[model samples]
Target: VAAGPAPPGTAPGGRRPWRQLALLSGLISMDSSESSVISVLFPALRAALGLPLSALGTLVAVGKLAGMVTGPLWVMLAQRVSRKTVLVISSGLWGVWSIAAGLSQNYVQLLILSTIAAAGFAGGGALVNGILADLFDDAHRGRAAGYLYAGVAVLLAVVGPLLGLLSEVHNGWRYGFFLSGAVTVAFGLLVAAFFRDPGVGAAENPGVGAAENPGVGAAEPHRGGPARPGATVLNRAVLRELMSSRTFRLILVQRFANTQLAMVSFGVVYLVDVFHFDNATASLVSAPAAICFLIGTALGGQIVDRVQRRLPDAGRLLTWQLATLGWGVAALLATQVTWPSIGIYVVLFCVLGVLQGFNPGCNRPILMAVTRPETRSAAFAVMLSAESAGWAASTLAIGYAGSAFGLRTAVLWLVVVLNLANALFMTLIHRPLRREALALRAATADTHPRTSGAENR
Candidate 1:
C-alpha cells in the first residue's frame, strides 16, 4: 500500500485522462446498478417477499445509512494506502457481497447482505471525485464531470428497461443483483489493471515545457504527495478545516434540503401505484428520462464551464440555483397534475432529469475551486455522507407519507416544496463561494508561483 509515482503517461494535463475518467464512470455505473434494480424491481420483490410499501424505504435507507459511515472511512483508508488499492477493494472486490445479496431467499437476508455491499460501494465516490479533480484543471473540470456523469446516465438508460423486463419472469429480480454483481466484479478487476492514480494536485502543476499540457506552465514541487501513515486520518482538525469554509458549510445545508433524489428512486413505484402501470411499462420511462439526464450533463457541463468563465464569481452557483428551482417546478407539474398518459409523465421526468444534471457539473467544480487537493477526498466524503443522510430521511418520509396520504401528495410536498426552499437557500452561498474560490486561487499562486500565470489564464 505504499504510495507510488503517477502511472506512466499520466502527467498533469495529459490527453490520456479521459480513459481514466471513463473507467471511473463505469465503476460508478455498475456500483449503482444494484439500486436501479431495487427501484425498478421493487414490486416483484414485494410480491415475492410479502413486504409492505414501507419496506422499500427500509431497503434504500439501510444502504444510505451505511454510506454515511463508510464513505469517510474509505477516504481515510485511501489516504493511508493508495486510492487505486482502496478503489479496487471497495468498488471491485466488494461485488461478492452483492452476489450474496442476490442469493438471499428472504427480506432480512437481502437487507443484511445489501447493507454490507453498500458499505464497500460507499468508498468510491470520495475517491473518484478526488481523482477527477487531480486529472483535470479548473477550466475543463465541468466538461469532464459532465461527460463522466453523462456516461453513467447512458448506461442506466440502456439498462433500465432490461431490468424492467426481468419482472416478467418468475424470480427474475434476483437476476438483476446477479448481473449487477458480476459486472461490478468485472469492472473492479478492470480498474485494478488499468486505472492510474493521477497523483494528488497533478492538475495544478503541469510538467514544465510540456507543450501538450494545456493551461499550465513551469512545474513546481508537488504539494500533495504520498501520505505518511495516518497522516490523512479524519481527525477533529480535518473536520474543523472543512467546517471553517463558509461555502462548504452552506453546501452541506443545501445537501440536506435538496431531496430530489428521492423522486427518481420512487418514480417506478409511483407509476406502479398511482398511475397503475405495470413494472414493464413503467420502467420504459427510465430510458428517455435517463437520456435527457445524459443530455443535461453533457450540455450543461459545457454551459457551466463557459458561464463560470464569463461570471467567475457567481456563474456556477447561479446555474445550480436556477436548476434547483426548475426541478421544483417540474416536480410539481409531474407529481401534482394528473397527466393523461405515461408519455406525458415521461416528458416531465425528462425535464427533471436534465435539471438534475446541472447540479454535479456545477457543485463539484465549486468544491474543487474552494478546497485544497490534499483535502478534496475528505471534503467529498463529508458532502456525500450528508447527501446520503438526506436521501435516507427523504425516502423514509416519502414511504410513510405515501402510505398515509398517497404518493402523489407525498412527492408534491417533499420533492417540490423542499427543492424550491433549497433554491432560495442557495443564495447564501454566492458571496462565500466567491470569497473561498479567490482565497484558494491566491493560496495556490503563493505555493506555485511559477504556474500562477498559466492558471489565471
Candidate 2:
C-alpha cells in the first residue's frame, strides 16, 4: 500500500525498474529500426554494386523475412535457455555481424549479413518484451513498457539522422555496422551479467525470472519435466488463449493493421517519392515525430496505470486505439493537402510522430494482459510472427502499388483502409476484454483481499 517498493532484492514496486528494463529494450529497438539505419546505406550500396532499383528494394523485404524466421527460434529456445542469455548472445552476434557487414566483399555477402544482423535484432526484441511481462504486475506492465519504448522512439529520431549525416561524410555508411555492433556487444555483456526477471509475491527476489504465481512462496527449482521430446513446438495454448480472448486478438490485429499502413517500411520512401523531400529533409520531418512519439508512450503508460486503478475495465485501451486509427487516417489525408514548405511537412510529421508514440504506450500492455505471465514469451512470439507477416505483405503490396498506381495513391489507399480495418479489430476482442477485466479483478481479489476494497470494480 505504501509508495515504498515491495521489498529489497526484488524489482522495484514488485516489478522491474526502467534501468533494469533497458538492455533488451535498447537492443531490440535497434533491431526494428532497419528503416532508419539501412536506408542510410542504400545509395552507397547502389553506387558501389551498380545494382538496379529493383535489387535495392528486395534487400528490405528479404531482411525482414529472415528476421521473422529467426524470431520464433529465439522464443522457443527461451523455454529451454534463459531469455536473458539468448538476447545477450543475439545482440553480441548482431555486433559482430554489423561490423562484418561494413566490411563485406560484394552485394551477395552484404545481403546475407544484413539479413542475419537484423534477425538478431528482431529476436532480441521478442525476448525483452517477454522479460517485461515476467518482471511486472499485469496491472502495470503496459505503462512500464510504454516508458521503455518512449525512450527508444527518442533514440530512433535522434540517431537516425546522425547515422544519415555520418553516411554522407567519409563513407560512414559502410562503417555503420561497426558502430552499432560495438555498442550492441557492450550492452549484451552488461545485461547478461546483471539483469533479472521479477516473479510476483516474492518479497525479496531479484527479477531475472519470476515465479508462476509470485504472490505465493518460491517455486520448486524446475528440476525435470516430461522429456520435452519434440522440438519445443510452438505452444498452441498461447494461441488458443489469445483466440479466445477478445482483448488479445484486438491488440494483435491493431498492431498488424497499424504496421500495414504508414507504420511499415512505407515511411522511409513515402517522404522521399511522394513528398519529394530529400533524405535529410525526410529525416528532419521524421525527427520531431519521434520526439512526440516518446511523449505519447510515456503518457500512455502513466495513464494506463492510473485509469486501471479506478475503473478496472475502463475503455482507455479502446480510446488509444481509436486515436491511433484517426492518426493513420489523418496521415493519409495529410498526403492529400499540398504542403508548400518544409515547415508544413514538419508540422504534419510531428503529428504523425505523436500518433506513432501512441503505439508503444498502448499496444504491449494490452498483449501482456491477454496472456498470463507464464506464456507471455510465446504469446508475443506469435504476435511477432503476425507483425513480421504484416510488414512483409505491406512492403510487397506497397511496392506493386507504387510501381503501378503511384506512391501517393498507394499511401492514400493503404492508410485509410488500414486505419478503418485496424479500428474494427478492437471490435474483435470486445466481449473478451470485458470478460478478462472481470477475471483479472476476481483474481486480484482472491490474492489480495485487503486491497480489493480499494480497487474500483
Candidate 3:
C-alpha cells in the first residue's frame, strides 16, 4: 500500500498497528528469555555445575557486558542492512546459540554460548524502539510501549511457573533453553514473512510518500536518501545532536543509576536461599508479580498518556520520577524488613512490580519526545547500552556483596538506595526535558507544516 498521511487517531502502520506491536513484542520477548531462564533456574545450575553464588553474577554480567557492545553494533548494522533483517538475524536466527548453550555440560561452555546468544538478543531493543516511534505518534507512544511490555510481562508470568516446574526435573534448565531457542527461531521466521517497516518518521509525517509530500516516508530527506538496503550508515552529526540534548544526557544518567534489575534477577534466588523455599514455591511470586507488573504497565501507559495530554511538559517525567521513588520504597520494605510469611513477600513484590511498570511507560515516551525520528535508534542504542552496563555492574556488585555481606544487606544498599538516588537525580531533567520537547514540536511543525494543525493539539 502507498504511504500517506494516516487518519487522526491512527498509526502509520495502517489500521492494524496492534498486530505489528504484538509481533514486535513477541520478538523482543525472546531477547530476555535466556537471561530469565538462567536467573530463575540458577539453583539447579549451581547444583549441577558446583557453581558459587558469585558465579550467577558472573554469568549475568558477561551477557550484559556483551550486550553493552553488541547493542550499538546491531543498531549500526541495521542502518547498513534494514531493521527487519537485523532483527530477524539477531533476535530470531541467533537462537541456535541458545540451543548450543543448553547443550553445555560445563559452566565455561555455557557462559561462552550464552554470551554469544545475548549478543544477538541485544539487537532487538534499539531496533524495536526505533520502529515503534515511527509506528505511533507521540500522543500514544506510552500506551504503545505499555501494551508491548505488558505482553512481555504476560509471557514471563506464564513462563516463570513453568520454569519452576521444570526445575523439578533433572537438567530441566536445559530444556528451558531448548524450548526458548526453538520458539525464538519460529518467531524469527514469522517476523521475516509478516513484519512491515512503517518507514522512519512515518508516524510523525504520515503524508510521507504521497505525491505532494515528497522527501518523507522511508527516504525522508532529514533521515538521508532513499530506502535502498545498505545505503544508510551511522550518522555522526545525529549522534552529536543526541549528545547535546541536556534531557538526553540526564536520561542516560537515570538509566545508568537504575539497579532494580538486580531485584528481579535475584528475587527468586533470594527466596530459595534466605527464606528456605524450594524452587517451585519461590517461583509462585513470579507469576503474581508479573501479573501486577502487566497491570501497572497497562494502567501506567494510559495514565501517562492522559497526563501528557494535560501537562505535556512535566507529566511523563514527573510520573517516571515518582515511580522510581515508589519502587525504592517498595524494594526496601520487600527486602530489608523480614516478613513472617511468603504471602507477605508476594504482596509486597506485586506492589514493586506495579511501580516498576511505570518507569518504562513514562521514560520511553520521553525519549521519543526529546529525539528526532532520525536519531531515535541511536538514542535507544546508547540508552539501552548504558542500562546494560548498569545491570552488569549492579549484578556483579550484588553478587560479590551478597557473598561478602549478605544478600539482604546487598539488596538494601544497591537496589533500594540507588533507586532512591536515581529518582532524586531525575529532578534535574525537568527544565531541559521541557525545553527539548517544545523544540522538537516546533521543528516538527516547520518540517511538516500541513500536519502542524493536527500536531499542535
lDDT of 3 by residue, 1-457 (tens): 4345666655553535788888999988877788988999998888988998898888898899999899988988877657778888999999989999999989999999999999889989988988888777787888889988887788789889999999999999999999889988988998888777667776776644112322123323323322322213446776788889999998888888798888878999988887788988888898889899999999999998889889878998988888889989988888877788889989999999998988777989899888887778889999999998999999999999999998888888888998999899999999999998888889988877765554545
Per-candidate local distance difference test: 0.83, 0.61, 0.83
Backbone clashes for every candidate come to 0, 15, 1
TM-scores of all candidate predictions against the true structure: 0.92, 0.83, 0.93
Show model 2 residue runs off by greater than 4 Å.
Answer: 1-16, 33-35, 40-44, 47-57, 199-234, 260-264, 309-311, 440-457
Runs in model 1 with CA error above 4 Å? 1-15, 207-231
Q: Model 1, residue 278: displacement in angstroms?
A: 0.9
**Which residue pairs come into collision in candidate 3?**
5-206
Which stretch of 10 consecutive residues in model 3 shows the poorest summed lDDT?
Answer: 209-218
In terms of TM-score, which candidate is strongest?
3
Candidate 1 per-residue C-alpha lDDT over 1-457 given as tens digits, one digit per residue, 9 for 90 to 100:
3223336555463437889899999998777888888888998899999988888888888899898899999888776666778888998889888888889999999999998998999998888888788787788888889988887798789888998999998989999889889989999999887776656676776542122323121121222432212224566898899899999999998997778889868989889998899999999889999999999999999999999889988889999899999999998888878878889999998999999999879999999888887788889999999998898889989898988888888888888898899899999999989888998899989976755654555
- lDDT: which is higher, 2 or 3? 3
Mark the regions of model 3 whose C-alpha exceeds 4 Å error after superposition: 1-10, 13-15, 209-232
